[model samples]
Target: MTATSTTAPIRIGVMGAHSTGKTLLLQRIEMTLRGYGIPVNRTGQLGKRAALVPLPKMQHHTVASTEWVLAQGIADEIAAAARPGPEPIQVVLADRAAWDALAYWHAAQEWRQETPHRHDRERLLVLAATQAPKYHLLLATALDPDIPVDSRHAYDTRYRTLVDQHTHRLLAAEGIEHHRVTSDPDSQARAVDRAVKLCLKEAVV
Candidate 1:
């Protein structure tokens, strides 16, 4: 069923570099919200999905792939918000968000030293920014190189670092308000607490 204007799901988005705990953080928030009897829909793994489109990812990301990722993410969030069920969804946890694609695209361009088409970059940035106002809360993770990533997935450390840097840079440039999450336990706890409180508050409203 489509949600009414007053009952639209509150969206919480998390974006950052690979293996920087974006998924784990959202999982924690989702579990906690469910414990409180709040229904949440989370959109994730767009990177893997994009790759299936045979779209270039990581350092090979192109404007087309980046645009696809951003568009798909927006569509996912829209679907989550209007999900049909016995109990309407109260929260949408966007794992990568739209801006996350822009970060990877920017990093890829920098990594390959490719000259970006200014108009294309502008269009992508504008597309990403359109969703900024929809997010009730935005969280960005800071990369801690000291923490070892899962060996199962081969990740380029340099490109990962660049993504992290561009993620923050873009957030700051857009003046988007977001909580910065780190690898520290206390930091993680605080981020989780903030999300829980926000979701709980929204539920009551």
Candidate 2:
């Protein structure tokens, strides 16, 4: 594998629309990589219709399942980055990134959370600047534009379009290679594996 190197294992983030198989894809990556005895880390917060609410005090808010998945993703990526290793690849699977922007953008447009406009750049800046370390591999998913949407989902898709488009470009500009996984889980997972191979190309002997 010949890919960009930062004197450490590459950092990765996996995020896509619902049912795009973000978790499934991550599972595949982990299963496949672990066969080689390489180090990997995984965490996610899924927004199922009904999921466990572990935090009693914060139960009122009852954070949605999707938020939990994204939070785990963020944390796992940060943890993986903190370690130094001789292996060429360390993979972190995050089911969603830039998820909060959905509510933030919606509030700006409908609830008047702020001005009438919300910018992807602003939300993006916040994500990149997190206390958590940054990622080098960003495997993004294209929303199945055909999927039906409720009012909330409709708004989310709109914001995701801008966010997704610019995220790929931003990472590339920073020398982080980008890959897009489609609707099919197997195909998407294969694409992710290939992307990792590409990112680790420089490490191949």
Candidate 3:
């Protein structure tokens, strides 16, 4: 669904595994919108902030960490949308959507071969989905093993793959509408174009 209220900023949320170009995609969208003179705000680096909470992250993510990530992302989006300014922000870009944490948590559980409590799992899913409706557009990146990553950082290939799988799986399970961005440059460009068009079109509505 499109943004219905003129007062509320159109929110575009991107989610995917680490180093999957989620941040870059949002940056491109932000730049394009700003070029059109659209005031925009972007929220990101939630994983880093969550790590500061002294909470387990990455392959070690726990329910507490996941909840914190989801809640904090929601709060950040709200604050961005409500930013006080003369121009008034027309769009808010969320780097990692709320359900991202849920995908990571699922990947962590599978990596550790641990079975979490059913109630806790369901609760987190519900919490993560709370912000789903607020997103005017959602983008999910697909991991491409062929696309080499930075050699400086040591990433767990297996776990990273798991996160990618779970990310798409969760999205499909929930039947949430989203654009799937791949490693192809053309695909990335199209995703950015879609986001830009969506914001501009919704703004005039």
Candidate 4:
């Protein structure tokens, strides 16, 4: 594989609405890349980690929680990129990135008919937008209601659909290019592998 131009590791963020197989896609991509002998590191959901304060669900996301998740995500991405590796072609696969947090913030606001704290929301929005370019591949998981959402996680169909819509619009408005993956597992793996190879090839040029 051609080494990326920058010292920064290539970031691949998997994002979508709730229950869209984001986690599965992240895992499959990492596994597929490793099978090819490429070095890859993975990052999980930052918002779910024990935060300074407990974060509420998407329908109740607060400004503080949203900002924390976004900041933690950026910090985690930086650390992932800086991880020691023998080769310069390290890839970082993130299950969910800052963009997802921003999308959820909007989703939550709309769902609850409430807006986040103006100052913090604006600040985090700016930060997320700036850092988004670090992601060499932002793969959007296609909304697949065929896959059931665990009731324990979130069972709101409306909320999930709204989040998916918000995320799609944000990516487009920000001019961040992304590829949508189908629900089929095999198809997902193939699509992701193709995108990763193409991205790695482009990076070196």
Candidate 5:
């Protein structure tokens, strides 16, 4: 890996509900960034790896599960920024972020009719926004009418949609800077390219 030109590596998050093409987009964007000789660390689906119960078997996970995944995601992002190599990682492409985890926690609570645990919510929000190395650009994959949702997630359309809605609501409430990438795959990749370029430009300035 090559060292990054900047002291802090640039972070970019690709976020959306399950099967919204976030992983594919993250891979493509990472490839593009690397072509420019940017040292990159691409993280994919932290929740899947961190969750105690396999995602396919669970409708909703416990708060401890959510917190565990959140902590793992934050730790990975921080470590990527601080990693030692020939070059600092210039770009860190994340499949989803801490905010996404928090959103899922909110959605799960709603589904179970559990009360709002304000402290947990606040803790996550603060860590995602402040303690964690924030994403310079967060690319959100919107659910477009033309693109059908992948059925592998048990095809619970209502649940998936609810999670998506909650994710959007949390993003808005936290005032995170993000752009929705919609349309076809080519357009989505282009959107990511543009966002990354803009972020790099700003980093230069």
Candidate 6:
């Protein structure tokens, strides 16, 4: 395949609910892509993925809840790992994204407004913002109740909406096109493959 000077490895991130086979899906993608000799890198395989679990120092902020923290860490690692544009297609699998909307909404009610934002907020946002242009695609893995599940908050539909909303906002703000995939792992993999084929084309001119 001919290469282009402006094109690079399309960075792909996979996100979804806990214990919903995200790891399995990630592995599947890596294996399938590798089989085709299409360079694919798993964050863990690189031994540098940042897991964004919340820290106890500042659990007070709802926006930086544990789940959100997990997402932030994953986002951070991907951002940090990303080299400037103009390279081959690279794929990074992050298990989660910023998902503290539920907690944030709950706290927004009682918590006093006008207070300075926490450190986590700035850092996490910076990570998302900076990586927006660096990534070619953002894949959101939906909660898969198929393989056993539990509603952290009664599986509240509201929370899911908020989660997707928060993610969309972040991606939009960063100027990146984000896509939400279904619970079916196969769909997720196929989507990535299709996106690569479509977006990673060689020089057009």
Q: List the residue pairs that clash in candidate 6.
A: 8-87, 8-88, 9-88, 9-89, 9-90, 10-89, 52-69, 52-70, 151-155
lDDT of 2 by residue, 46-120 (tens): 343124555311112222332443455465556655556675345555555544323323322332223432454
The C-alpha stretches of model 4 lying farther than 4 A from their native spots are 1-8, 50-52, 85-89, 116-120, 184-187, 199-205
Better of 3 and 4 by lDDT: 3
The lDDT for every candidate, in the order shown, is 0.89, 0.50, 0.89, 0.75, 0.68, 0.47
Model 3 residue 38 CA deviation (Å) reads 0.5
- Where does the lowest 10-residue lDDT sum fall in candidate 2? 55-64
Q: What is the C-alpha lDDT profile of model 3 across 44-134, one tens digit per residue?
A: 9898888787888899999888889888999999899789888788899999988888999999999999998999999998998777778
How many Å off is the CA of 166 in candidate 5?
A: 0.8
Model 6 regions more than 4 Å off: 1-7, 44-91, 94-123, 144-147, 150-165, 168-176, 195-205
Q: Considering lDDT, where higher is better, how would the candidates rank from best to worst?
A: 3, 1, 4, 5, 2, 6
What would the TM-score be for candidate 6 when compared with the true structure?
Answer: 0.53
Tell me the tens digit of each residue's lDDT in model 6 across 1-205.
Answer: 1112235444555554334455666677667666656555555321122123323212143543443454555555556347354544354444443332222332332333434356755664554454445445556555544444444634444444444454455444554456667766567767657655544352121
- Single out the weakest 10-residue window by summed lDDT for candidate 4: 1-10
lDDT of 4: 0.75
Clashing pairs in 1: 1-84
Candidate 3 TM-score over all chains jointly: 0.95
Q: Is candidate 4 or candidate 5 better by TM-score?
A: 4
**Each candidate: RMSD:** 3.2, 7.2, 1.5, 3.5, 4.3, 7.4
Residue 120, candidate 2: Cα error in Å is: 11
Predicted candidate 6, C-alpha RMSD = 7.4
What ranking emerges by TM-score with the best candidate at the front?
A: 3, 1, 4, 5, 2, 6
TM per candidate: 0.95, 0.54, 0.95, 0.84, 0.82, 0.53
lDDT of candidate 5 over 1-205, digit per residue (tens) = 1123334567777666777778877777777767766678877657667544554212375667677777777778877777789876767776777677777777777777787678876776676665334666677777654567655656566656667788788778766667777758677967777756854664432
